[model samples]
Target: MELQQLRYVVAVAETNSFTRAAERCLVVQSALSHQVARLEQELGTRLFERTSRRVRLTPAGAAFLPAARQCLEAAERAAAEVAAAVGEVRGRLAVGLIPTVAAVDIPGALRAFRGRYPQVRIGLRVGPSDELTEQVREGTVDVAFLGLPATARPQGVVARELGRDPLVAVVAPGHPLAGEPVVELGRLAAEVFVDLPAGTAGRLQSDQAFAAAGLRREVAFEVTTADSLMARLVGEGLAVALLPSRYAPRLAGVTTVAVADAPERVEYAVWSRDGRTPAATAFLTAVGIDPEAGEARPAPPQEPPSV
Candidate 1:
């Protein structure tokens, strides 16, 4: 079967409407439908069940869909590789990161990457560290930025350590502990707190620290975004939160206290172990990382301009 036929089939399967699929494929409805029909006939089975009301994938279609997608991806990667050999980078860059990443300025990095490789399409996903790590391992994400407890490392992927910082206590300006220069985990445990969901990498750092100290803090609020909802909770004097020291300074309306015995969180940049796309490598370079060495590269010194 032709690659164009496979593309038509995939588009129809994803959109679930022949007309919409044709629009997406930049072809007329009849041409797209005819190609899909030809593909099905060649395979001697109907791929989709078509009714005037709705369109659904048949059993055969479901079985064929995944392999079809793989083929399309392989074809795209081959083309990208061919272009890369000539010192051209053109592909999609899928980036995933936790909300609290601090080692690199993500927006600025992306802006530089876009200026350098304008042909590459960029997509970003914000998620928890664990989920982003998994996406990197699964090849769905080209690269990811993660923050995990110092005791843990990203598994089954190529990773480079970005930085590490101790957790700090965030409290409202008028809260009792707000004025403290440094606080112990035990003391923070005695107060109500706002934190990330249990078992998430962000939450686990504080949880493990408290458990090690033989203390339990009541989490009055469990939120996903620390800079937004969790900060709001702490700012309103409802509860306190434990966040990475580097990130805490960015939160307004809250006071950050040093945690004398707080758990440390490590930030890492991870990518697939199998290989990296040229676009992914270009992005890592833009951020001053060496993808092959898994380490930060020294910035090039500026040269004096000729008069």
Candidate 2:
């Protein structure tokens, strides 16, 4: 079948409407339907079952869909590679990150990358660390920034440690512990807390630390986004929270106290081990990271003037 036919099929399958798919593919409904019909005839099976009310993939369509998408992706990557070989980076860059990432300025980095490579299309996904890591390993995400407890590393991917910071106590400005310059985990454990959802990497850092210290802190509020809802809880004097020191300070209307015996959280940048897209490599470099070494690439020394 033709690549255009595959594209039409995928668009229809995703949108579940021939008319919408044709609109998305910038073709008329009849042309798109004809192409799909031709492909189905060539393969001797219907890819989709169409009713006036709804459209759904047939069993054969379900089987054919994944391979069809892969073929399209392979074709796109091949084109991107040829462009890169000529010193032009043109491809889709899918980036994933945790909500509480603090190691790098993600917005600024993306802006710089966009300015440098206007031809590249960029997409961003915000998710938990574990999910983001898995997306990177699966090649669904080209690059990811994650925060995990010190005891863990991103499995089955190429990762670089971005930075590590101890967890700090965040409380309302008028909270009793807010006045303290430093507080121990045991002391913070005495207070009700707001934290990431149970079993998440963000929450695990504090949980493992408190358990190790032979303390238990009651997490009265569990939130997915720590920067907003969690901080709001802390600022309202509803509960205290343990957050990475680098990120806690940036929260408004809250006081951050150093945790003397806090757990350490590590931030990491991870990518697929199989290979990196040229767009991904360019993004890393634009953000001052070395794609191969997974560290900051040193700047080239200035040349001396010839007299």
Candidate with best TM-score: 2
| 10 residues in a row with least lDDT, candidate 1 | 298-307
Taking the tens digit of each residue's C-alpha lDDT, what string does model 2 give over 43-62? 99999999989999999999
* TM-scores of all candidate predictions against the true structure: 0.92, 0.93
Which TM-score value belongs to model 2?
A: 0.93
lDDT of 2 at 268: 89
Model 1 Cα RMSD, Å? 5.5
Tens-place lDDT digits, model 1, residues 10-87: 998999999999999999999999999999999999999999987889999999998898788788889899999999
lDDT for each candidate structure: 0.88, 0.87
